[model samples]
Target chain A: MPTSNCSTRSASGLALRAVADTLPLCIAVIPWGILTGALAIQIGMSPLQAQLMSLLVFAGAAQLSGMTLIASAAPLGAIFASTFVISSRHLLYSVVFRQHVTQLSRSLKVIMAFILTDEMFAVSEAHTKRSGQFSALFALVSGFSFYVIWNVATLIGILIGDTFKDLDSLGLDFAIAATFIAMTFGELRRFPVFIAVLASGCLSVLLKPIFTDSYIVIAALAGMLAAYVLGQEGET
Target chain B: MWWAITGMALITFFNRYAFFADFVRYSPGAKVKRFLSYSSYAVLTAIWAPIVFSVDTQTGFTHAGADYLIGVSVAAALSLLRVPSIVVVLTSAAVFFGIRFVI
Candidate 1:
């Protein structure tokens, strides 16, 4: 009876985990959405433009970078270029997600592609690994939920941004950086992973001078290459 | 703005589609799977190292602020202790804010 109960609990837990995995991404979207709206207003973007960007792009990093560039009165080319550089990581997300998401319908896949962001990708990938089950429906539900919450939060932020003008002074911005660091560190439990991280750090530092704004992309490629070589050797 | 956003969306979609098409039609080789598994660390580290190390400077190496160092130390310790992620985040943020206020 105890063993049977344990199995039942495990099965339910797996299902719950699938649902709960998306919760973090959804919660995180709210703060970032608010930040985008507030920043857009502060930078003189009209509410319509701010909302449109949030609705369409659905990328926090690119939107933030683009807004910063716009505020600085950078040329359109420069703004686009900077946004591209910051968002290049999405390419990696798309590639990784594609492997598991391919069996999904074309329409569903297209929609997932639009809503894919760093947190959503991380949660989705982790869920896949943990559950050992691939349900495109789950992925769609998680991704779509996150996307909706994000836009709603942005709208809220735009509506009430004036009331929270002191958000920066409160240092809430640091939460974003801290959250990512915590998440990454939690995931790094093995030596190969640790070494890959170190390699990436070194490469980013080494390449910063030469690559300027594109150092992150260069570092990611170099780190992946190094880790791949090392991981292959370990397997052999 | 429309052109740039649309272009980016297209490129991103294509990149994602390539992976689905490639892996679905043919399983990725062991080497590629190994690479993908290990790639997360490199990608994340690459993103964060710059922020932590270059928080003060624009391009070159410089002294990371005490709060930054303390925050990371606390974070690393919590990670090593195998604390839950949410706890680590909240504690580290609290530590950073406390230090920032105290000194």
Candidate 2:
């Protein structure tokens, strides 16, 4: 039987509630979208290509990293490698969500998977974690709406193109750093995880400037392994 | 360029859909789950480190520059205080432009 505070709500109600839940986060993303769109045009990307990246990639970190690399004239392989490493976190996200959505139909599963971004997952997870109910309507409404909002933000950015110069000068890129740092700190609820994060941060710093193409991947794997090893030791 | 985008989309879709591919039934050990939980920090760490430390300049990969460091420090400070990410971004921008305008 259904239970919890969310059990009685209609899908649309839950959807609105989910949107409401994420309203502050969404407002924050608007400026980011505008900044990215403007950067894309600034970096010699066609307005169409910029918008297309927003449409297709749908991952801000990936898109920003991609645009930055392309702007720096990084090779194609390096660009792909960097973005791929940045996004590999989604692999874990898919794993975490799989058990919840397994009972749903394949199409819904596909949509759920497609629309799963960090913020959407964070907001929806807050609700579903309590109830464990993978309501299709709720998930769809939340994720799809986030998707629309991101696209609209990107469009606004594209429209505002090129008056801004030097993303670093604007310090807008710090938003991403802040977001990622929040994600890191959010997970550090345990004492031992501190060791894991420290290991990761140090390894990444040391590995930077060493491997041109795959430092991020190497450092991340090293960090995860450090955590896994230390965690196992701590448990034993 | 289109190929690059297409290839990336394929990689990402594969990841998002990978666990549901019938292979995810073999749940890993508790250690793996615990480890996966920290993957976010690890990944974010790797992504942030290079950007924060290795600031590119017209001359070379020399310094983090006042703007980048100031921006990062402001964002990091506000974030530590539990400000929202969007607000952190806005504050960083405001501070950056603010300082530049005065001096």
Candidate 3:
């Protein structure tokens, strides 16, 4: 009974921390989710479909990629391949998370995997790395919070899509671009990051004609390699 | 719609589940960790660059209104000033929209 009580208390404590950690991420995700919903509708998705995509895939990049492929009438296999390539980063996330979250049960790991977006993974990994605390409950809380906000935002965007046809005309898409730019610049304080960015951009441009849909993956791999090499050289 | 949605969800789940089941047995090395740190940067920049440089209607690249150039400038300026992220986002959006309106 004492062990049971201790476990329960620890689980709740972790859940509380996860919720706290996810609050800021949810705020950012809301706008992106809404934007995605509006775009989905603009591109002819019904509200139900948009919300369902959000619920199931729970990945902004993959959803956008899938929608783009559908709009372009790409083959079903191509759509799946492209999304899988684009989302391969999640593999990296799982590898890193495994280091800290090894104690979690299989059921908990599966559920957490369902909700692990780039942002959630980043925040949770950082939290655990900094504090050396691995709480499956916290991860679940954060994941669920993000999931709720993302779907709700998608629903809101779908509802408002008709009312806001000028969203793109108003340059709302620039928000995503701006966010990326800000994030990049924030990392430019380091030389390895700068090199990685330059390498990826150049490689992607060069490979675009050859790889077409898979350019991003190639570019990312090239960038990661370049950064890794540079970091090793510096340390040596 | 249902078919497409379900198919995509299944693929996503498979992609995620494979990592957890297969790769979680060992910790990533220092090299892997270093590489992962900049993974998002590469992916995000790859996505952002085309949007920034490609013209809306044209196939070729042109700065034109330079919407991204201006928006990035505002963001940098705001960061330097230590303005809040909300402020930076709103300011950049306003700048982009205002430019679109005038030019």
How many angstroms is residue A123 displaced in model 2 relative to the true structure, after the best TM-score fit? 5.0
**TM-score, prediction 1:** 0.79
Interface C-alpha RMSD per candidate, 1 decimal = 2.8, 3.5, 2.8
Please write out the lDDT profile of model 1 over residues A1-236, one tens digit for every residue.
Answer: 99999977876665466456655445535777888888888888779877887887777767777778778877778876776776777767765675677667777777777777666666666666666865565566667777778889889888876778776565454555565566567656665666677788877766766776678777877777776666554544
- Chain A vs. native, model 1, TM-score: 0.80
Q: Mind giving the per-residue lDDT tens digits that candidate 1 earns over B46-99?
A: 766765665225555663577877887887788677676567767887898898
DockQ of 3: 0.44
lDDT of each: 0.68, 0.69, 0.72
lDDT of 3 by residue, A85-171 (tens): 777767766766666556667887788889887667655654565577665666677789889999998999888886776654555
Better of 2 and 3 by DockQ: 3
Model 2 lDDT, residue A163, Cα: 67
Give the Å shift of residue A70 in candidate 1: 3.3
Q: Residue B48 error for model 2, in Å?
A: 3.4
- Poorest stretch of ten by lDDT in candidate 1 chain B: B15-24
Residue range A1-236, candidate 2, lDDT tens digits? 46554555665577787776556556557767887898888888787888888787888767877888888987888777777776676777787677677787888788888888777765565566446665657667778887888889888888889765554465445555555665455446555566666777666666776765456667766787887777665543
Evaluated with lDDT, which candidate comes out highest?
3
Candidate maximizing TM-score? 1
Instruction: Tell me the deviation in Å of residue A11 in model 2.
Output: 5.6
For residue A124, model 3's alpha carbon misses the true position, in angstroms, by 3.5
